[model samples]
Target: MVFPRPRPPERSDPASCGTHRACRSCWRDPGALPQGHGRIRRYAAGADLAAQGEPPADILTLIEGWLLLSALLSDGRRQILHIVVPGDVVVPLLVGSAGFGIQAATDATVCAMPVAAATTSPTAHPAGLHVLMKAMSRNAAMAYEHLTAVGRRTARERVALLLVELYYRCRRAAIPDHAVQIPLTQGVLADALGLTAVHVNRTLKTLRADGLVAYEGGMLRILDPDRLAAAACFDVEAAGAWLGPCPPGPPTPVPPTAPMPPGASR
Candidate 1:
């Protein structure tokens, strides 16, 4: 199967958000946000939403587009630690998992809120706190698995795992027909996989040769998803936990002042 070229990132518009309701998971409990909390924000491609070493702020939920959370080595080399896609939280774990900053890989939008406001607002809802804790625990587990990929997997294995991960993420977002619409560059893939661009290109070529992945322009299609996942040593447990319950009223953005859980990592 050949994947079509991904369209350009969606332009953000603040007036476009319909209502200020909490996310489905949060709203489900009826006790999530205080009666009058939450805010939405839009970001352009290459925008830095959260920088490393900065004080904790509101948690960010990715309403659209791709995002990268990376950290700098002592030598200044950047390592792409995690990729945040639609429905994923940018800073869900806590304030001190690692020294990583979050940025948009493409045009994106998010709902951000202050950490303190989230926990302290007199209107804090118990149901909302329950959902938030569950989300953070889930994210923590994923970070551990991704760390394993970088530390123990071969370069090819790492790339395969990453693509499989992306495929699942897109699917959970209910993106049509299992399509991956992110404009992931070779250099970005290299950073995420902890390899050089040359190595990334070579591995992609190999996947193409095996007919496991089809690439055109910058888009990629997993022709034989089973084979691809197998090659990557994909973990069903990690993938399963990565996706939360479906959202209500489609995907939407939240306010930037959302609370920051102490355990939120990236």
Candidate 2:
């Protein structure tokens, strides 16, 4: 199904909005913008950003919230391919018509731009294509990590690896404290980890009992990150370097400029 892009709402500077550093980095000149650039659009929880089998249109950069790239089976079962956090980009052509769908895991804000604009001359959009390339590389690295988790690791290890991944990602994003809001239910977790929801619950319970992690009130806390990393065999620093240096301290506010592109809604 083809989706229409919505008009962006007038807003203050993109930098002031505390957008992801990846998004801010895409702008070569924060003070100037190309003519007819895309606009930002917001999606409520459960919205579909892109559907499987649809022709590719725009490239989406997540500015806020979490998104899931998933595929549905013939029997109506869904397998989540990836958890897309802020600072990530969704390029439909990468997965092509392999039946992958992009959906918001939470209320999300994204910037969509024409694929041509992003792939055209780098001189035209400046850092836009460069940042997109880096984001794509990072996504590929994450995919490889997920493959190892699902194809070889035990269920407990799978869960541990996921938590470790999120912990480091949040830290790199400078999301304040060590605690993270998982924003995923047991069912979703099961799908992502290729386990049954019951199994996911059991593994989480075991982790809690071991004082390695805590999941309560919609928050997931790593009580012993060191132990959790050991269990998952995850090296936070060695995961990938495609995600450029995370800004120290709070998110540095950028000067406001024209908005980017509009994303699709479910």
Quick one: best TM-score, which candidate? Answer: 1
What is the lDDT for 135 in model 1? Answer: 67
Off by over 4 Å in 1: 1-22, 25-27, 92-98, 243-266
lDDT of each: 0.64, 0.66
- Encode model 1's per-residue lDDT on 1-266: one tens digit a residue: 11122232234334322254425432454446544345667677887776676566667767767789888666667888788877776544455643677778887777665565556677666665665677677778778878899899998899888877776666566434334465677778888888988888788778878888764443465676568889998855546756543223223321111111122222
Q: Specify the poorest-scoring 10-residue window by lDDT in model 2.
A: 257-266
Tens-place lDDT per residue, model 2, 122-237, is 43455555656666787788888889899999999999888767655655554453234557777788899999878877787788789886544344556776689788887766
Give per-model CA RMSD: 10.7, 8.6
Error of 2 at 185 (Å): 0.5
Q: Model 2, stretches more than 4 Å misplaced? A: 1-22, 25-35, 94-98, 121-123, 177-179, 215-218, 242-266
> In angstroms, how far off is 36's CA in candidate 2?
3.9
> Going through the candidates in order, what is the number of backbone clashes in each?
23, 6
Q: TM-score for every candidate vs. truth?
A: 0.78, 0.77
